[model samples]
Target chain A: EPEVTQTPSHQVTQMGQEVILRCVPISNHLYFYWYRQILGQKVEFLVSFYNNEISEKSEIFDDQFSVERPDGSNFTLKIRSTKLEDSAMYFCASNQGHFGEAFFGQGTRLTVV
Target chain B: AQSVTQPDIHITVSEGASLELRCNYSYGATPYLFWYVQSPGQGLQLLLKYFSGDTLVQGIKGFEAEFKRSQSSFNLRKPSVHWSDAAEYFCAVGDGGGGADGLTFGKGTHLIIQP
Candidate 1:
């Protein structure tokens, strides 16, 4: 079965530095999303992208966060300034249509120091 | 607002034993419910979902869930579990009639399959 894929399985960055997490959603999927899981915490939704624009976002997705589908296949989340609290496992997901079941990627572990 | 609740934080059961994970939700309208599993260092994998139709929904890997509208719950159950079933399970709720922007997830219940 085709699945979502994320790059840089693990990353370490300094505080105040910029970081970009990349994801390649399933080729035929139309809705894409980003979620984060702090260590020992529940997964939290960050943002959702569809039709080349953001559909909705959570409070955690503040000014520092931005998502771009620079190309047809790649969905990228950039944090203008990384903070210690930003460290977590980021997962990318995609669904075929509205309210459809979603498939998720393995996730990228971001570590800020 | 939509929200999910998984009451048990962690549960341990011997291999071959039956298992059930409880989940409850708070939604003003009909809710789309889902169960997902995550192994250590891995991403979340959809276990099953309930939208409309039968109250009971079967899913991959020998798992199933019952949607009880009266109780506002969707609980996951398996007749028999294997050692590999050890993982963290999460329950999520979404607005059934609205767009996909309204999913809220519970913390999760860790399952430990003992040998």
Candidate 2:
């Protein structure tokens, strides 16, 4: 079965440095999302992208966070300046269309020190 | 606003015993319910979903859920659970608006199976 793939299973970055997380969603998927889960916390939605633009975002998705589908297949999330609280497991998900089941990637563990 | 509530933080069941994980939701409209399972250090996997039609919906891995409109609940159940069923189960509610809206997930319930 085709699945969403994320690169750099784990990453550690300096508190003020930048970090980029990459994901390659299923080829045919039309909707993509980024979610994060702090240790021992619930999964929280950060942002959703469709048609090469942000469709919706949560309060946690502030100006420091940005998502881009640079190429047709590659979706990337960039944090301009990482904070200690940014340490979490970041998940990438994609779906065929509206109300469709979203498939999740293994996740990228981001640890900012 | 849409929200999901999973009451149980953890549950233990012997192998071959029946299992049920409770879930409740607060949504204004008819909510789209889903159940997902995650093993240790893995991504979330969709077990089942309830959009419409039958109140009782069947899903993969011998799991099932009943959507009760009156109770605003969609609880996951299994007739006889196996050791492999040990994992974290999450209940989520979606807007069903057919867009890029994300699902609101509840705090998961950890299922422990004893052999």
Candidate 3:
């Protein structure tokens, strides 16, 4: 089965430094999303992208966070300045259409020190 | 606003025993309910979903859920669970409208299978 794939299974970055998380969603998927789970916390939705633009975002998705679909296959999330609280598991997900079952990537563990 | 509530933080069941995880939601309209499972250090996997039609829906890995409109709950259940069934289960609610709005997940319940 085709699945969303995320690169850099783990990443450790310095505070105030930039970090980019990459994801390649299933080829045919139309909607993409980025979610984060803090240690011992619930999964929180950060942003959702469709048609190469952000469709919706949560309060946690502030100005520091940005998402881009640089190419047909690559979807990337960039944090301009990392903070200690940014340490969490970041998940990428996609689905054929909106409100459908989303397939999630294994996840990228981002640790900011 | 849409929200999901999973009351139990953890549940321990013996192998071959029946299992049920409670989930309640607060949504204005008909909610899209889903159950997902995640093993330690892994991504979330969809177990089942309830969109419409039958109130009772069957999903993968011998899991099932009943959507009760009156109770505003979608509870996941299994007839006989195996040791491998031990994991974290999450109940989520989504906007029925076809928007990019993502899912709202509950805190999750950790399942421990005792031998």
Candidate 4:
């Protein structure tokens, strides 16, 4: 019953400020992903990471956003300049590999003021 | 391209009543379908998934889904629902077109259980 864990259950930041969200995926997982959910909207895929590089990303994942595995256990998402529209619940998910079950973290609520 | 559609935006059912949430998908090839539930202010929890094999798949919390290839639908159902089952349910489809990418989720359905 291993689970993905995200730090800073909630975050508040001013527009144009920098913010970083962290996630620790399951130890054996080989693929990691980041998704965002705006209030009352569908969960949208942001980015997917595998083999220490981005595998696939959506149009919403623009230059302003970047993801990195800073260390063995930490996968982080950095928003270079946050905008008010960036306010949403960001979820981190991981899967062992293709066709494997993906587990989601409790999510980090990012509130950009 | 892949997408998921959850027809009902919101549904209300009395306690101890049966429940069914509809989901449809648009994807080429044999797609991987999944159902997830999220409590208020929490992350998505995997209820069940269907890759291949039996069209009917049983999941945790007394939930099950049927995959209809002809209709391209994967509907979730529960014989009896409790107040605890009140949450947001999302239907997602993965790219079985051969890629290790993420899933495309539907807008989600908000379930309300009357006491």
**Whole-model lDDT per candidate:** 0.90, 0.93, 0.93, 0.93
What's model 1's lDDT at A58? 96
List-wise, what DockQ does each model earn? Answer: 0.56, 0.72, 0.67, 0.62
> On residues B7-91, what C-alpha lDDT tens digit does candidate 1 reach at each position?
9999999999999999999998878889999998788899998889999999999999999988988999999999999999999
Worst 10 residues of 3 chain A by lDDT: A94-103
TM values, all candidates: 0.96, 0.98, 0.97, 0.97
- The true-versus-predicted C-alpha distance at residue B8 of model 2, in Å, is 0.9
Per-residue lDDT tens digits for candidate 4, residues A1-113, read: 78999999999999999999999999998899999999889999999998999999999999999999988899999999999999999999988887678899999999999
Ranking by TM-score: 2, 3, 4, 1
Q: Worst lDDT window (10 residues) for model 1 chain A?
A: A94-103
Task: Give the Å error, residue B5, model 3.
Answer: 0.9
Model number with the top DockQ: 2
lDDT of 2 at B70: 98
Q: What is the TM-score of chain A alone in each candidate?
A: 0.98, 0.99, 0.98, 0.99
lDDT for position A38 in model 1: 94
True interface contacts reproduced, per candidate: 0.47, 0.69, 0.66, 0.59
Instruction: Enumerate residue pairs that collide in model 3.
Output: none
